[model samples]
Target: MNESIHVVCTHCHAMNRVPELRVGDAPSCGRCQQPLFQGQPVALDSAHFDKHLKGDLPLVVDFWAPWCGPCKSMAPQFAAAAQQLEPQIRLAKVDTEAEQALGARFGIRSIPTMVLFRGGQELARKSGALATRDIVAWARSVIK
Candidate 1:
């Protein structure tokens, strides 16, 4: 049997399986029928966060808050990184203020922190804001 990839929908929190070779074709979720990668980071709350964590793709989350300047500055960079990193990775954002429990659970001490997860495991983490290239490089390094 050919290998398959498990992708959790950021739009509807649905789990989807796609053929490994077809991952570059912009697959949609079977249940929600939404594109799995939208070329942007998905905003997630605590309730929907764990669903992506369970997926097969590496999950890169930007933990940020509205009141933070650095977080705001990093938003566009994160979005650009999402456009560059799709299919191979899933990018998301969690509002620290809205999801305090998740921030605390991850021991987030600063705004604009990024955490990378795969197979429900924390692979790497970075704090503070970074440019799009840096984000892509860091994620690719961790994946390799």
Candidate 2:
């Protein structure tokens, strides 16, 4: 059997065993059959945040609230970026209203903030909504 990484499906919260080497490839949830990177961000509760921070791979989290205009506006672009960047990065979302603790710990004072983390450390963060290209560019720059 090949060693694999356990990726938590953001859609159904199922654990997916993905080939370790294919972390950058387009992957789908085994049970849900949904694209792991459907391009839209995955909602991350506090538990999910904690679990993924401990992961060895890089993580991209979008902290947004549903009611925020900018957040809603950027949704499609964010999703597109997630879809294109799957496998190489894990995309997640933290609903500021739902995950209050996470928002505070991360010092999020605004909506539509994005943070890139690796090995439990924050590599970079940006506030305000951004386009899909900008999102991918930022992640790529910081992850390198």
Candidate 3:
């Protein structure tokens, strides 16, 4: 029997069951018919955050604001990290400015904070901008 994993759709927030072997085959959401992993960080708001957090794959979320210099500088690196980390991990972004409640809920006191979650629980958190390599390494280390 093939093992399956639950991946939340980034576009529609629908839950999807993907065979483990086909995770890298570019799976699509059953409800919305959108690609499951788009190779980039998905922009999330409070409405869709909880489902993504509860997915079987680990979730890496960057809490950032538009005016923060470090956050601006880290956007490209975060995007690049998404390319390297998807299928195994889901990378997402929450604009703190637009989602103040989420930021507050996560106890984010600083911009450019990256939080890793698994099974709807926070596994680890880091505060600062990280290079693409560092982002991948940090997430991998935490998940391991």
User: What lDDT tens digits, residue by residue, belong to model 2 across residues 16-127?
Assistant: 8788877667788899898665555677787667776765558999999988999999888888898778767878888999888999999999989999998889999999
> Please, what are the lDDT tens digits per residue for candidate 3 over residues 99-118?
99999999999989999999
What is the lDDT for 62 in model 2? 91
In model 3, the Cα lDDT at residue 12 comes to 86
| Counted clashes in each candidate structure | 0, 6, 0
Cα lDDT tens digits, model 1, 47-136, are 888888999999999999999999999999999999999979989999999999999999999889999999999999999999999999
Ten residues in a row with the worst lDDT in model 3?
46-55
**Candidate order by lDDT, highest to lowest?**
3, 1, 2
Off by over 4 Å in 3: none
Candidate models: Cα lDDT each = 0.93, 0.82, 0.95
Clash list (residue pairs), candidate 1 = none
